[model samples]
Target chain A: MSIEGSSPKSLFDKLWERHVVVEETAEAPAVLYIDLHLIHEVTSPQAFSVLEGRGVKVRRPDKTFGTLDHSTPTLPANDRGELPYATPEAKSQVERLIENCAEHGIELLNMGDPRRGIVHVIGPELGLTQPGKTIVCGDSHTSTHGAFGALAFGIGTTEVGHVLATQCVLQRKPKSMRVVFDGLLPEGVGAKDMALAMIAQIGADGGQGYAIEFAGEAVRALSMEARMTLCNMSIEAGARFGMIAPDETTFEWLHGRDYVPKGLAWNEALADWTDLRSEIGAHFDKEVHVDATKIRPMITYGVSPDAAAPVDALAPEPHSEAEKHAADYMKFNAGKPFHDVAVDRVFIGSCTNSRLSDLREAAAVMRGRKVKEGVVALIVPGSEAVKHAAEAEKLHEVFLAAGAEWREPGCSMCIAMNGDSGKPGELVVSTSNRNFIGRQGKGVRTVLASPATAAASAIEGHIADPRPYLFAKESA
Target chain B: MSFDPIKTLTSRTVVLSQENIDTDQIIPARFLTTTVKDGLGASAFYDWRYDEDGRPKNSSVFNGVDPETHKILVAGSNFGCGSSREHAPWALADFGFRAVISSDIADIFKSNAQKNGLLPVEVDEETHKKLLASPGAQVTIDLETCEVTFGDGEKGSFPIEAFARRCLLDGVDPLGHLINQMPAIEDYERQR
Candidate 1:
């Protein structure tokens, strides 16, 4: 069981070696069996159609889970939305998923079910996302499930169809990139800040063609929610996926859950998790280290996630070819101070930052303030579970009282897949990952900021420091 | 449907033109819901070839061109940017684009295209400019010689990693081509 003599193997190496189907060759790509396949309403239709066209059924239906989240309307507790069930598009898509799942006998956590939420959020909450699992979804944010020590990745519809029919995917194993974040984060900094800071250090395409393994003290100490945020932005950095090794934090999050094994089986699972860490001396193709303490409250100022600046720093001056190119496209003034930059809107939601904690933080800032005039602030929770949790804490009331539009759970305004979008030329201070041009809407500029910054920006109508609120609260 | 692979690509002169066109833009998020066959051909250049009116915009390079006649698409640097949607290549293939000439391509998009039967040809900037200037210039793409011949009989050499080239010449996808290597996989499994 030892790896290459007495040297200890990193959890990544162990899991990869354990799941090695065969070494890649010139003609043949390695085929790795998937442990879990999470599907949403958006991307499963074509995959199902492909299967039907081929007269093929899902190969491992038992390993699959389907749900409706991306397009589900989040209505207030008192008033249900106009749509009785899912939206027409969502309903049709969900129907396709349900029919396909039934035909294949796969589990479907349809909308309105307590377990149904954003595919990323629900997977971990229900304990279906576990260590050493190979999780694939049709959404890029599928990397969010890798927080549970699983090798999770997103696939397109064609690949989804391939997986449905074969239970395995033809994949070229990615080179491992280790991103080690050490030391404790300062107050006002959260997982979103950490992820943004990482993107800031490494340009958006730094991890291209690589699978990032997030390690070190900071990553280890992150809660399951925070870990999900960390892995959620793997695609933002152009990495195939980002993963963390399973530990007590991961097991604790999974325990007592309905889907998780209990009693004697739990202990057996723990023993299995012990082997999930990367071995000492295990080699990585690339290694990046970011000092967590050095990271500040971050905000993206341009088209890409990497086009970011610290809360206290001015907008970056592009000296390099890549920076100049991105800056020209983004129309951002080089070396210009970003402190007084005006914002037309503030959005707090996405697979990256729409959790209960993110809502609570934004609520804390909006408790006694109203959204500034001409500034539209929207708070969309990541999932129904998160929305429910926010209601339980009265965070929604705080947001609504502050004139913020508290919308339902979904990837609202994240990529503007649905009707939720920002107007062209509007400057949006978003908590979502990626500030790329037209990422929110055509010509709508996005400035990715922390939740506190987003809330403050909504209140002030410009980028402002969140530390003052935390400091004032501390003094009180 | 089968054609002579040896005689098919007589001209290797592929033109390269668009920049940072992502896979999502190629197939778009909407078309992703339909069956591959139903959605692939018409949706290849959905956004690029049409105006907001859904009419074929006259300015679109791909618009109004006969599919069989337009065998090559010259694209600018960093083409195929967004999500790793393999439908990009499927759409490209269905549109009768045998090869995409670009300075560079997104990693996943390139791999997907190569895996599925589209030849992604990478060339230098100067060479790309020259190919673009050669309007309606059909290049003799010889899979056997692995070279692209311009209209002027100038041949520009390009490297297609041995395996990928072999797969393209054989007219088989990577997955289908791998059937020949099952014995090695079986032996490895036995050892394990």
Candidate 2:
């Protein structure tokens, strides 16, 4: 894969070079080919309208896939079988995607289809997200696919249209950054904790204008699902692209999935993917190393994701106007430990931590414990596949027994677009990615944490560390 | 949809001096259900600009300024950090903003702004500080020279890709240009 006599290249450099249809220059960007374009109800409508207005058919319908998320509700119907859409427009968005996909001859995982789920969640589940491919979606968490060692990123609707019409996107080469995690992660800390810890070390904008390659001992030790969780939040660190080199774990997780190649082709794909890692002496524009062992179960106390501290730490004193503003909005005692921060709601699902393992983690904490009285806890699986798998394991009974609502799969309560959100002024410990102001709901204070921490917090009615519950189970 | 060509614009600026002002603050996810891309101007920064009762907030800078005259929005560093929603830029353009100047702009947002005809200008920190300190300061953006002229004759050059710049100047639709390269795309796909 190396160019003749050229220096050893990083993983990102290899992926970028492999996808270039036209080289970048002073006058123009490189026209990079898109290997997979994941579309969903919320972002694809306008892109489809633009395509219809331009009077062009999709260039490669085979490479395009659609799913319904965001606008679709997590609540199922009663006797009438109505979908409880948040609005008429929300319902129409889902209907429009079905129509658009039918017209364009693209495959769509429609509602009630077992394969349907959050766009990011379903991509990897279906094996459409493969190593060395360039994946783009209108959703920022498109970086989720990069865990397979692909060059995946989020694109605006305009670029979505460009990819639909031409199968190529105009992209300038971004700088490369390697974020290395030193040492093994502690017992209670998971990938979500690692991600928040990294964002805290680097400011929210630390990885801007660069493609971040997550490397190091802890990252290598993470399971495929955990890797996706880490890469999924790369956008929060302001990196458009985040990836890991594909290895045995990646191939094992992807094997025999719906769209992945068969036996002979699988061997060929494996050989190509094995070469996808960065070679020695590869150059990086920047390198950051964080001590993973020191990264306890983390939680964000401010509107920004980087406003994070360990679960047992005291609420930080405000340093800037922004920090003061965040403190006022979040309403935490300045010097009190987060353990005293009472929780009003708990949301244990999002593209960030709604996979099977994430559900199992939450279920383990809730197996015999009860959600504190008056605290509304909702457990929404990421996808229907995740839902069915969890149901087979009877995870729903554990959540329901603990007084948490077990809901259908979608991007529920994550963006608050699907009629699932915290009430105004309520404090919610959520496993979702962003904790932006009013993101969960107007005037709502969002504390981002891992599934285990969220589940433990729900049980205690406060921000409780997960180590006690996890250790108790190990001893049992 | 071809945007109106933006060659030069002179306008007073509205400043939101908050770092990491993400797209959710620009246009919340709830207002994104529309199949078309129009009328989002009213909902741009809905939570910031309006109260729960749907009335404009008295403290919001948006309510104090006239969109027609204040076409330049000067924001703090790392503006438009989260989400890949083009509605963020569409809402800005629909609200009559022609250019956004920041010390650091998120990569996807800067791309979306250019395609939708809203200019994204990234200047030096000193210039950004000056702009942030002076709200409603008259600013001039000249795409011809890729420079932003502001208070007291101070100026800073911003970078825009040459292709994006040409497309903005011509008011040509980039999708059309990309569509014309269908043969090249097909050839590349076939070789792969």
Candidate 3:
């Protein structure tokens, strides 16, 4: 994408080659230096125990930061400090995170910290996520940071411990993929729709063993916030990482941030980041193209993210033998409309779509409307700063007046480990990634949708397209 | 830290004949609350391997066979496909599956399995089909030679990189390679 580069090295190759702490050999894996290592409560405890057993301190502790997200509660919507965990077991995990961070001298943004939020959300908000950095977390959604043109991906717990001890993890160079979306986006579509649409086209395993670069005019047209949402769900498509080339939009979004470079350093960084794109004739192992004009506000009906369809279309008849089983698991009868499905619970939160822009769109839908009776709608902010920012904009009043519970920021209902879940046989229209069976709760049917669709569905008490409502607002 | 080295695994196979059987299905998020790893063994494959209301299914794949008897898992393409939750490998390894035989294995899952003392062996389409036909078939995987031998002498060879093979055969993590080369790393750092 940059004009100055030659020889056509892809963005992934540029990032990977610079981070090679140890080059790969015929007999060994390459050791890549991790610029940012994120730790969370659910996956870090066992890893910390491994570190203790090995008696090795974290290498370059400054580059590592800890937060408790996946296992914390979002209840008590006030300053009650109830530590109001869903269960005693959840409490112990957070406590262990505190102990581990303290013992290891790693900084943690705990429940009470104002900066505390989902790791992916707070990382960019604080400017810890930047262009050309190699980041890793135990959660697969670490792909979220790739929006800033950084090479970020997830790793397992043993790899987590390995990075903790050495500031490096064993990795092989992934095959390169370029999925370019050309043309203008249609009305009422967003990054969430684009992501779901991508996964729908490429099967769940299509991007296996590849690092994908989401490119072209349509991807470049999105805001930084929307780009984050797009990159965040790249893992669901099975790509090791998804990236976009850093551009003016990226630099504008990152300018004057807390953790970014200052003054002279900022100008130098801006110049370097500007030149960070692939060369003119870069080659990829695989290439895919999507017409942005064709994408709709998409949602997943079956368990996998690939089971996506437009709100106007009927539930697709299962073609594969595996799809038939997926439909059966979701209890979605073939030939039924994907729309007008009844909703028992509507959750407007998750790392996938809980940012301020997400709240604005959801609140726009909730304005002058009330949630249908008997439908439990909870809108959780991604972080405390997000919570305050939304309240400052009075998004909270719109949500509360529309009969939804606006709660504190945390990873609620996404993991189902935080005591927030739909009851058995209940249908939940959620904005979270991974509608896998039992992901929300035991026997709970989950439909993955955008925040706007979730908000409209809460009011209609079923899955309804958000486009009509947004069109009404435009006309008004 | 050296754990138990895996040279061979001879056991009855349990078949999950579904493609893209993800990590979430292997171990659901609800049971991912503990730091300890033992109880996870009991809850592996909780939904399919159990009935609702917290009762174990009498005829499920896991319950029908003694956990001590079946030490191998047979699945289809894209197994362990979702979430980098090491819990998937932890649950499988804790449940005593020393090896998995599949037509294709996911990238992240293979790496996680290598470190957690679980072997992911890929076979040709014919072998996978033959393995699927026989439900209670006994299979022996020899890690030293990367060969899988069926009870009736149907043999197959799966490729393993030399470095990973040494780590698995020695029950060591790749980090051991780096730790062993600390002196060389020091020399390079000094020159820089």
Identify the candidate with maximal lDDT: 2
Worst 10 residues of 1 chain A by lDDT: A77-86
List the candidate 1 regions with Cα displacement exceeding 4 Å: A1-8, A74-91, A317-331, A474-476, B1-20, B27-70, B74-78, B90-96, B102-104, B114-116, B121-192
| Best of the candidates, DockQ | 2
TM-score of chain A of each: 0.93, 0.98, 0.97
lDDT of 2 at A151: 99
Error of 3 at B154 (Å): 2.7
Which 10-residue span in candidate 3 chain A carries the lowest summed lDDT?
A1-10
Q: What tier of docking accuracy does candidate 1 attain?
A: acceptable
Q: Where is model 3 more than 4 Å wrong at Cα?
A: A1-6, A77-80, A474-476, B181-192
Give the higher-TM-score candidate: 1 or 2: 2
Query: In candidate 2, what are the lDDT values of residues B80-179, reduced to their tens digit?
Result: 9999999999999999898999999998999999999898989988889989999999989999999988758888888878888988888777777777
Tens digit per residue, CA lDDT, model 1, B101-180: 77666566776677556777777777677776775677876767767777777877666656666666775544333334
- Residues A148-229 of candidate 1: C-alpha lDDT, one tens digit per residue: 8898988866567766776666676778899999898888787888998998798666777788999988898888889999
Among incorrect, acceptable, medium and high, the docking class of model 3 is medium
Model 3 over residues B1-192: C-alpha lDDT tens digits?
Answer: 435788988899999888888888899887777887665777788898788877887867776776688889999877888788888888888888888888878777888888877888888888888887787789889998888899889798888766767888876667766666566554544553
lDDT of 3 by residue, A11-62 (tens): 8889987777678887788877788998999888888888788788876678
Ranking by DockQ: 2, 3, 1
Better of 1 and 3 by TM-score: 3
**Per-residue lDDT of A1-476 in model 2, one digit per residue for the tens?**
45643988899999999999888889878889999999998888888998888698887899999999888889898688888998998999999999999999999999889999999899999999999999999988999999999999999999999998888899999999999999999888899999999999998999999899999999999999999999999999999999999888999999999999999999999999999999998999999999988999999999999999999999989999899989999999899999999999999999999999999999888888899998999999999999999999999999999999999999988899989999999999999999999899888899999999999999999999998998894523
